[model samples]
Target: MPVAGALTPIDWVTRFDELSARRDRLGAVELDELGLAAWFLGRAAESERAWDDAHRAYLAASDPDAAIRCAFWLGYTLGERGEAVRARAWMSRLFELCGSEPDARAGAIAMLCRSVGAFATGRLDDAAEFAERAVALARASGDTDTEVLATMNRGRALVFGGRSEEGFAYMDRVMLAISSGTVSDRVAGPAYCAVVASCLDRWDVERARVWTRDLSAWCDAQRGLEPFRGECSVHRATVLRLGGEWGEAETTLVDVCSRERRPETLENALYWLGDLHRLAGRTADAEAAYRRAAELGREVQPGLALLRRDAGRLGAARTGVARALGATPLTGVRADLLAAQVELEVDHGDLGVARRAADELRALADTIDTVYLAAQADRAAALVAIATDAPEQALTLLRRSWGAWRRLDAPYEAAITRMHLGRACRTLGDEEAAQLEFDAARTVLTTLGAIPDLARLERLAAGPDRTPAAGGLTRREVEVLRLIASGRSNRDIAHELFLSEHTVARHVSNILAKLALPNRASATAFAFEHGLTQPA
Candidate 1:
């Protein structure tokens, strides 16, 4: 074939296929290359077959070291595909071969496998120990591939064990090695994915954004490569979304969702699609994306609940979010769910439940200590404080959250936090401060095209009591206008407001006159149009 790294994966695959068709039997090294080529082209079955054949050939030729490498790859690929039993069998075979050879490279691979197992089973201490042993063995053997993999594993374990700084340090070094070409091609793909995934899991958006760019470039260099391409697209889309490039983010997510074969990667793309659609106020599209992700066994939460709330289905939103928080354990975006729960409960006027969720979120933020989590925790606490009439406390938290969101370059979140700040300022009678905050938030939301948030801000700025009294109509007249929109007659309004029929009739006339409406029907339409009423 071509010399190593001279041809793209596509070119390598074409040459390998031509040779395989012409030859009676390909050599073990050829088969190994074919396996990697097939994997890069998303041909999982072909890759497995080639690797298995190569493993058998290596054994037949008494090359146990090469055979052990093949076995490690087979186990790794199978485990990634969720074929746990088959993966375990291969790993077991790898260990058995290592027992006979007793070499440092083989020992390193075996230790890495053990670390993976322990981590999967939640034995963080054991996982960390095994990963360190693997690292030591790989270093002794001068196996850069095993060293990178083992270091990434140790870092991941440390992150999971609540030592995020140490874990990321290890992961960062591994990434540097990968960037410097110390890592082999086979190890490079997995290494890039591992470090980026860890960065995203911790909500280190800045790190994720930078690494995702590197990953995209790396993927682009290897034409026909599919294993890590989906993840790269998903991560790039996230960075784009956070940076307010909604159109491009949507395009990337849609492309990945349509093409990605891996269920987990596709699920992530779909979930992000839902969130982007929801923020853009495309309710039906968001629901469809979320439903598809849920079908693929993704926990499409917080975003789905927020969608319900945006549609004015507050009860459904509260119920769904509460159920999600109750069912989900404290891991893997649980902090996001808790933050949503706190906000939903606050909006539903359940201050006690909101406070509990806020407390949990605060604790999670303290433990995670990431910018995103900290911002979410502060905002959730601010919402609870606002509901409980602790305006000063809410203001303090909102400023912190606002600064964090601004630092993260998340215009949408920053604007939303400013809206909270406005509310707190209004509650404390700082009218000028409140007005400035509201005006700033409105400008950002208007620019972002965040329809629901923009609408809410409009209502907040409508009147002193957050009542929408347009066209110079008094608050009492606005109330009458809303009732009229609900199809309430003058007599019904009179009874509800404990006023005389003449007084209620007078208020209705004044509302129509102030709004320059010809009749009650026009008045009703005007009320709904101006945020004084909503559809049932």
Candidate 2:
């Protein structure tokens, strides 16, 4: 529930409505920043003269796109105010200027300029096409800024297209690039951070922390970056949760959620709260947070995949994660990448599916200059390789991902991929290599205090080399060793005695050490000979 202090929805709507309708005509050609902002927000207090003033200044600016962008925004303001025909005429003028332009990114800019018109009236497909064309043009020109814009636009289309993976990848590239120090686009770093922060739902917290660290530092250094401060705070909270700093994480999220005005912001914060709770093993609290996020996400991105995922766990419906969605298409790298995700090579039921996905993503290297997206492409390809049981291919992709993640200082992702790499190697019978990778990953997980994961790694590493010590076992250890001899899984032991799996594992280790048993076989023989299952 929103605090009583929060502004009512009706009040905001009423204020904005009044602002949009109260335009005066004086100095309508030379609008300043304030004037343009009011016009953009449809505020009633703005005068037509503000738009005029802004238009004049835009014309006076050195950049050609500046004048054209002003023309479109002014036209949009007019259109929103019921001057559709006049707005269309202005848009036509902007399009004309987009052609034969001298700027290196003029083609991309032109494409995007055209897409905005399509997007204005909810012609999402048309907007996607234009944006896609813009991305292609931008990439062709080798302009990283244009590429970033194209990727963001493309990501929007991909999301609308029911290709969440593709949309996520494109946006990830833009965000990763920005956070990793390659923010070459019209969208400012802090602004895009909001978008990135909004995407944390259901993502692995450790993996997310890698990007959040850099993002947090950048947000601190930048001023006038308040638009996304709420989100940044939420991200920090998530990292703290992943690091096992539970109290701080919980406090931060609760505060952020309370203070946030937008449904989107609050919803995102709530979603992360759910994640934090779940990671801490608080099933009930996790469920509540997930329910809230699902309810809120339904309003914006209808049938959100992440919601569907949570709904599944919380006994909610399978409504959101549809196999097929009636989505509008996207243009450029966004579309290409999204298409690639929905068409995961796994569905093809062959090794070629993974290869195709990889190929599709690889084709985008020239389209966007964000290393983050490139890493995703590699990781996606690696996943495909794993599905196809191709260890070599998986290794190659993992290696690429590692390199990119290192440059981005994304240790969590690196650690995750390294774990996968170890698995791939283990499957290929390279235990020595597997053990080393597992050990490295274990160290990182331990620093982050992921006890369960650390224990699992320890177990995996202990699989090949150890034997029980030669000695008599203590009574408690003897009982645990007897269970181990019976071929019981950790789950079975935990259930039988109501002890935690971690505790059971510890007992088993103690037993092995006490009896000097070299292996499970010796422990089993010793237990059978002594009738170790009998009560003392």
Q: Count clashes in each candidate, considering only residues at least 3 apart in sequence or on different chains.
A: 0, 29
lDDT of 2 at 48: 43
TM of each candidate vs. truth:
0.84, 0.45
The residue-by-residue lDDT of candidate 2 on 431-505, one tens digit each, is 679878987887777666544445556765665323343133433455566677788877797777666787667
User: How high is the lDDT of residue 14 in model 1?
Assistant: 73
Candidate 2 segments whose C-alpha is farther than 4 A from its true place:
1-115, 119-256, 272-286, 298-370, 380-389, 450-536
Candidate 1 lDDT tens digits, 281-361: 888999999999999988888899899888889988888877777776445478888888888888665878888988988
The Cα local distance difference test for each model comes to 0.84, 0.57
CA RMSD per model (angstroms): 8.9, 12.9
- What TM-score does candidate 2 get on C-alpha atoms? 0.45
Worst 10 residues of 1 by lDDT: 1-10
